[model samples]
Target chain A: MTALAESRRRPWILRRRTRRIVPVAILAAVFVFPFAVMLFTAFKTPGDVFSTPPALLPREWTLDNFAEAFDQIPFWRYLANTLFVSGMSVLGTIVSCPLVAYATAKVRWRGARPLLGAVLLTMMLPPQVTLIPVFLIWNGLGAVGTYLPLIVPAFLGTPFLIFMIRQFMVSVPDELIEAARIDGASEFRTYAQIVLPIARPAIVTAAVFQFVWSWTDFLNPLIYLGDPDQYTLSIGLYSFFGENDVAWGPLMAACVMFTLPAVAIFLVGQRFFIGGVSAGALK
Target chain B: MRMTTIRRRRALTGLAFAAPFLMGFAIFIAYPIGASAFYSFTDFNLFQSPDWVGLQNYERLAQDSSFWKALANTFVLTATGVPLSIGIGIAGAHLLNLPVRGQPLFRALVYLPTIVPVVVGGYLWRWMLNSQYGFINYFLGLLGITGPGWLVQPEWTKPAIVLMTLWTVGGTMIIYLAALKDVPGELYEAAEIDGAGPFSRFLHITWPTISPVTLFQVIVNVIAWLQIFTQPYLLAQTRLNNASSGPGESMLTYAMYLFQNAFSFLKMGYASAMAWILFLLTLAVTLVILIGSRRWVHDGAR
Candidate 1:
């Protein structure tokens, strides 16, 4: 009896240990393999990159490819352009979206339901459906090839972000808003003080999402910003592929460079990242 | 009387909050959308005032071989890609939700693709699938099998895009993970107590619990797929001008066609008609799904 019980416990312990180790090992490989490959390719010579049984590490690790990547385009200029566009959009979304979300969530209004429904409807309409119209609208205003077309939409408040913040705002304790009202705080003041601070997680969440979207936004920048000098990193990368023939080594390096900022932000904000993504599922 | 005044004041304040969004909607969304509908009836090139053609563009679209080809390609992509991605997403989410150790790290790994800019992801895949010296071809060589030219061949191009899309279902997977967490634990326990197997438990307990999420993902996925542009556009534009658009037009997606007509060719009026047609297709598809969802999607929480 004692031997059987010990045997049963041993198998359970072994199974648990295997379960723990196997997933960790597999997960590490899944995340690290591509990153390792990308880093290795970034350093390789063109000859070495195209060779069979490609060197896991470059035959001669050097900064030659990185240098070439920089020379191939105005790397810093494109980076700066991307930063300006994405940064301004993130700031705009943060300022406008939360206030709009708070009103839709907490304040009583007649057109509230219809308005929210309208916003939801926007998601269903393919942005492609309005592409020509928006282009014409911007061209009429002479805002084509400028940052205004890309950045101004952020100020108007995005329907998606409005939905996210509203979902988060709905959960704020009613007493907190009531207490502020009793103290004669104006609605704007109450939102600024009580609501914004309380909704910090959702704010951080929204900022991170907006920043990523704005940074990676290839379609808008492609359509609006026609000038080579004004191109974002995304457009710059596309141009590299377009104007030049295959230069795989340098091209991968530039892609690596372009991808870094978004990855850095996501890693830093990982704790709050999944919450924002999951908001839609809950509602 | 005072309560009614308070209500009126609240209504004004609410409008005040929505003012920025409403203004943006009118200018950016509503106006442009309304304008497109009007333009669909005209013959406007970008350089001149639109001529009132009155249904000529729509009639031309019906006879346009390329338009039908693009529409068919878009449908094929959505029909294959959307369901497969959703299936992979839900499965991945369920696996991640198991009480396995290192769960957070693994969850982050699966989602790593989503954080990478789509442009970068596109280039990376382009390199990997390159016919000469690409990693994927090399792997097949090790198996004593020769790999087909993935992006270069027309028959292979759409499949290539579908493969690339599967890598980024991480966004939807995260949503599914959250929905799974909200499902009641007791339901699973009761299934275990019964003689129910894993498949049976999943069908009975898990499916019903997460059906709403499945419906939401399906609807959004179909809409997004109908607007597929970047991959096909990049693929088309990068290779040979029209060839990259789709394999001998095999990959010329409806969104790419709309984009080409609007921007590259500057056929604004024709593009507007195409956009409205797309709008109607999306609306019709969404309505079908909405009606069908009534039979499956549970609103137990509500």
Candidate 2:
């Protein structure tokens, strides 16, 4: 009983008997393990990669895989294409999502409730429902092979992002908007000057998430981009794997490089990103 | 007259703000919904005009073995994956919620995998899941347990996907953590004063408090899993960019098969029919869960 009391008295970091830390450590390790494998494997020589009784860490690290991945796929070109698409999308979300969210959330109109309901319905509806027809629409417009299929959707407010930003905006006090309106500011002026500045963090959250989604998206790019030169890193890595099925080192290297920008952005916007996900659940 | 003018202007301005999404909904969502439903009833390949076939696509779907296999695969993954992910996420949140040093670091570590690109995640999972040289089997062998070929064997393929599904559960964990944090601390103190143990406190207080969140997460997971594509596609893919359906077609999830029909086989009508079927099935499952939640979920609305 004395020992139990003393154990409970100690700071948890110093106590071995603490229940939570052990499981947290184990799960954290499991989470980090695949990434460790990705990193270690990227630096390993091909011989070491396939050697019997495989080692977790490299016997000898090499830069061969990084060079090979570049040669195997036009890494920089795909990177530029992905950056362009994802960058444009981040801009797109920043412009459109907040404008719509402000109208639905702050502006009092009878259509607002119905519009919010429509937003929820669209958010819940499966993308597969519209997959083929949308593809045909793009195919008809002759936008199939270009960035239009990839980038154009971003200009349209994504339902999930719109919903999230609106949830954030709903908390903005009505008095603020009313005061602005009473002062002879038009609705657009009120939204832009009074609301948008206050909603900047939410917009930033929306923007970062949009960039990441476009960066990581595969299915749309797979269908839309016909030419090999046009491939984003998401599917470009696939062709890399196809050509170098046995070249695990290069594949792993390419994957690490492919993953870095998103990780960096996630870390930078980590606070906003976590907040955005939960806002959907709670609000 | 002046007041009415102001009201009309405000209404029109609101309409102007929402125009992009409304236009997007009509062009991207509304038109496709109508077009797909129409196409589902006819044999309309990409280049050709629709030829009415009544329920032929549905009939073919009814009789198609590949469709059944795909359906079975999807059902198995969704059934197993959704519960495990929610359980882990909630359980993980509980653990993370405990006062400990470097809590943020641990939380970030857990979440780091989620931000990894799916293409990257898929390939990395495949690499780790490799039969002989892969780290997963290597670690298993070190523990004196012979690991199965995760990607090669048909029986193991779905489990591999489930395991991969579990890997990126940090997203759900973060959401659950947020929900858990929203639970007032005084409730726990009051329960403790009543001499209720931790388990009982969680059972009576925490469980009911987070049930709505759990319900939401469960529905989201169900919807996502039923359409699981990129993971299995990358996992089961063969070289030269062919989307192999894994060993013995075990990896042919419903969405993948639909994609195959739409793009590979160019069976546009059949694919559209499959799409509607998937949509209805998702709706049914979601409805069931929502209905069932009435008994369990404690709505703590502010």
Q: lDDT: which candidate is best?
A: 2
Tens-digit lDDT string for candidate 1 (A169-278): 99999899999999999988988999999998888888999999999988888888878899998878765564567777887788888888998999899989887788
Residues B1-302 of candidate 1: C-alpha lDDT, one tens digit per residue:
99999989988898988888999888888998889999999999989999999999999999999899999999999999998988988877877776776788888878888888788777777777777777777778889989889887888888888877777887888899898998899988888998789899989888888998899899889988898888777655663223257458877999888877887787889999999999899989999999999999987888
lDDT measured at residue B148 in model 1 versus the true structure, 0 to 100: 88
Which CAPRI level is candidate 2?
medium
Candidate 1: residue pairs that collide: B236-B244, B236-B245, B246-B251
lDDT of each: 0.84, 0.89
TM-scores of chain A, one for each prediction: 0.90, 0.93
State residue A45's C-alpha deviation in candidate 1, in Å. 1.6
